[model samples]
Target: MRRLVARDERWPLREAFVIARGAKRQAHVVVVEITDGVHHAHGEAVPYARYGEDVPGVLAQIDALRPAIEAGADREALLRLAPPGAARNAIDCALWDLEAKQAGVRAWDLVGRPPPSPVKTCYTLSRAAPAAMAKAATANARRPMLKLKIAGADDLAAVEAVRAAAPRTRLIVDANESLSFEDLQRLAPELVRLDVQMLEQPLPVGEDAVLQGYESPIPLGADESLHTRADLEACAARYTCVNVKLDKAGGLTEALALAQDVRARGLDLMVGCMVGTSLAMAPAMMLTPGARFVDLDGPLLLARDREPGLSILGSMIEPPPAGLWG
Candidate 1:
């Protein structure tokens, strides 16, 4: 006797969110709410087209699990039930929420993690021409850290623009797997000169095998190329860090494990989020303490966020409010 509710939601972004891949004006997400009659909890997931996930496909995956979930299947059962992706992420988080409500405890406590404290988050400068990107960077100039999306060689001018606008702000350039080794090498000097703290996923996953012996001036991080704990071994040798998004690792359960594995291998951890609501960012906050960088600014990009959202005072994300899912 559990109840499961699943649906799709669309939150309009304040403006088009541009990445190396493309542009999006809205965040399309799948939401799940599970209840044990007396108490309930929610989870949210963005059906990333990059992962070949669409709203219908993700919902169908959850529908397939309804019988088992209603029969009291736990989060571990979900890992085997659904392949790791947006679908699994939504359900896994929902289960965590439900369990927390049932035990009358916080989600972090249920997961055996420390309660979150406010952390500095990366404000993203979407992919744009140098001037536009620079203007955006200047607008967020006060932010402690900024993540610049690099689409190609033209982004050199964009980086220069941002640097000119915000001289003191720390920078992380996420190429989103758009650069070849030569492209990466050509930009390395400029990136270091700009004092860019991190270079993220400049090369595509399959093609990144060349990174093993490359001498990179700036520390590089993996986003698209790193997934579960399984990716830690190979990525540790190639990347100095890995960006852990709950969508990629399936949920908080796997993300915690991935973070532990990344640390065990001496790789830096970055907790990132796809554009969604605060519900998505709240669980990710659990990983923030150990992360080298935090990119949980999804709600800030949206035109409107759900009530009881995580408070954002400037670029810092505070812990989740009680009314919001843990």
Candidate 2:
């Protein structure tokens, strides 16, 4: 016999996490658990408002599937059952965790992906004033890579401030789709000069089509615009890389497929995350192999994370402990 459960959780952030979109003081997550009397496993997902997902809706989606999942529905069946989003992510990952625990093997082993090793992740500097961002960057100068959240036309000012404060640290800039195509073109040369390694979603999803065939100095990656494989072909023409957040891909099952599709398009991979505990990052960690960038520092931003969390020191992230999830 099988049992399934889903519930909502809220974790306070150590400080407000500010991005181009806005600010979040807490990470709202939906957790799913599955068991067969003894062997048990769990998965966690952050419901993102940008993707039109909310806690109640995600929980309802998971709740609706309990009967099917308990009746022996598998991961493959889950892809067809739920559209790509947080709800499916929770259930699919929980299924993987349950299967791995039942089989006495790691989730990576089951997926045919290589065993996970320690990965270098990017520390995010929240959207802030130029002086404040520089101060924050200086405080975190030990980090190897810093992902700056940029918002306005004055992004170059903020980037310059951060770069000057943390000269040795590599940088990735995420505009969160706030820049217009003209502004992006105007800023590309300056970003390269600043030695920024990448730019994430500089323009809004609807406005991103303008980036197609526009040569850029720094690599441009798709985030909100690139979800399932359905967005692959179009994204290929617009950006050089794609950010795969498990919440957007649904779960590990489809994330693997999406990464495969990304490679087919000759785009670089970046495994990112929505703010949550280590339970969320554990599964996302499985996708970091050979990825150009890993942005799994969500747990680092929280005031407190669950026990057995991923060990993160600055930008260096150790793989998730077995007891966490996968």
Candidate 3:
């Protein structure tokens, strides 16, 4: 019989990660390992509080499915066994890794995708005062792209400051469900003037209907408003792009399908990640081949990353080695 193992780990951040929701000093993650005596594989995910997931709760969820997983429930069966969330994400990715090792082939090969090339990821500037944000932007000025976390108030000032600091850096502003329709309308023109290429989740989830007929100067991406394929139809009508995260989509199994569906529907794709370690970001690289944006900078924000992590050269992230995760 196959054996399954699950545990929680905490990795401290280099500095506090502040977003519209709040601040976090460390990443709390759930890790899963699956082995069949001879071969082993691992996966990791972060339990997001916004999704009502805590480390203890996610651990419990994984433990509840231990029997089924060890009983030979494949990735397809996992979809029915657990709802989309951090718990299922860890298990699903672990199974994918296990399969890759068992077959002696790379995970991307099994998925029928080319090997992931080194993709340049956007360095994130956490929510801060305009001056502070500018300082952070200046520090990362050499990076090709920068994503700023913004709230409703003084957002324009912050973006302007960042633009002035890093004039050539492509910018993406994420409101994290903090903005209203009026806020987006008021800021879109100013953001465009500041050369901001995209705005993410500016409006709250249920309020996206207001954008159906609105014209935006900058392309808008759906994050909290779009989780999986189930949310495609509604989100496609309102947003120009969708940000896919493995944890939000449950795992690579669903994430790959979601990424393809997003592209097929003519929406831009952005592969994003929560504040976690390299193991969490490793599986997400599989979706970056044709992505319009890649935000797998989680490990960059951490004080220290797990060993056998993906090699990050400057802002470019290399794919995971077989020794890591798929």
Candidate 4:
């Protein structure tokens, strides 16, 4: 029989992580470990309140499913039994880890994908006063790309501030579904002027249908607006790209299929992450080959991380270290 262990951890961020919705100083995540005989594997997920997930609730769900999961439940079975959320993410990831351990291969290698190498990624400039945001961008000028988070009417100033601060860095904007139609229409030209490469989820989740008849200079990506294959038709009509998060998509089992489907539809893809340890980012890094952007900097915000972590050089994510699961 396999033993299942789950726990909650609150890692303090080196600095406050801001977005249009609010600011955060701590990243709360839930971790699950499954062990049988001498083999052990682990998985992690951020308890995103925005998605109606709380640490206690997710842990409870995992505890209830421990017996079934340890009894050799497959990823699909885990998804069906737990619903799609942090609990399922942890369980799904744990299964992948176990498989990797038994096969004596990294998860990426087992999936027929090359291990992660250094890849340029977008570093987030969270919402703040224009001046403060500019300072943050300036400090991170060496980063190849910057993903600026904006909210409300001050967005224009935010973009301008970052552009001025890091003139050479490629810029992307993520409104986190805070902008209105008027905001998009008014900001598209300025975004172009600032050389913003893409815009992510400017409108609310279910309301992205507004982009059906809209036109903008910068490519628009779906994050909160798109999750599973079920969201494809509407997302296809509205977005030029889709951001895939393992937690949101269930796990690599589903994310891989979703990526293939989205690519077939000709949409640009981005692999993103919630705030967690390198354990979370390591799995996500495996999905980067076809991605136009990779936002696996969740561990970068943490004041500490799990031992034997993936390295982040500026905005580039290095390959996972040996013994780092996935």
lDDT of 3 by residue, 194-295 (tens): 888999999887888999989898899999988889999999999999999999999999999999999999899999999999999999999998999999
Better of 2 and 4 by lDDT: 2
What does the lDDT read for residue 67 in candidate 1?
91
lDDT of 2 by residue, 1-326 (tens): 89999999999999999998899999999999999999889999989999888999899999998999999999999998889999999999999999999989888889677778899989999999999999999999889999999995687999999999999999999999899888888898999999999999998988888888788888999999998888888999999999998999999988988998887777999999999999999998888888999999988999999998888876778877779887
TM-score quality measure for candidate 2? 0.98
Name the runs in model 4 displaced over 4 angstroms.
Answer: none
Candidate 2's C-alpha runs over 4 A off are none
Candidate 3, TM-score vs. the true structure?
Answer: 0.99
lDDT of 4 by residue, 1-326 (tens): 78899998888998899887889999888988888878888888887888887889999989999889878887878767877778888888888888888888888877787776788777888899889999999999888888998886467897899999999999989999898888888888889888999989999986767799787788999999777788888999998999999888877777888889989999999999988889888777777887888888888889998887888777778887647775
Whole-model lDDT, model 3: 0.93
TM-score of each: 0.98, 0.98, 0.99, 0.97
Identify the superior model by lDDT, candidate 1 or candidate 4: 1
Q: In candidate 3, how many Å is residue 57 off?
A: 0.6
**Better candidate number, 2 or 4, judged by TM-score:** 2
Candidate 4 TM-score versus the reference = 0.97
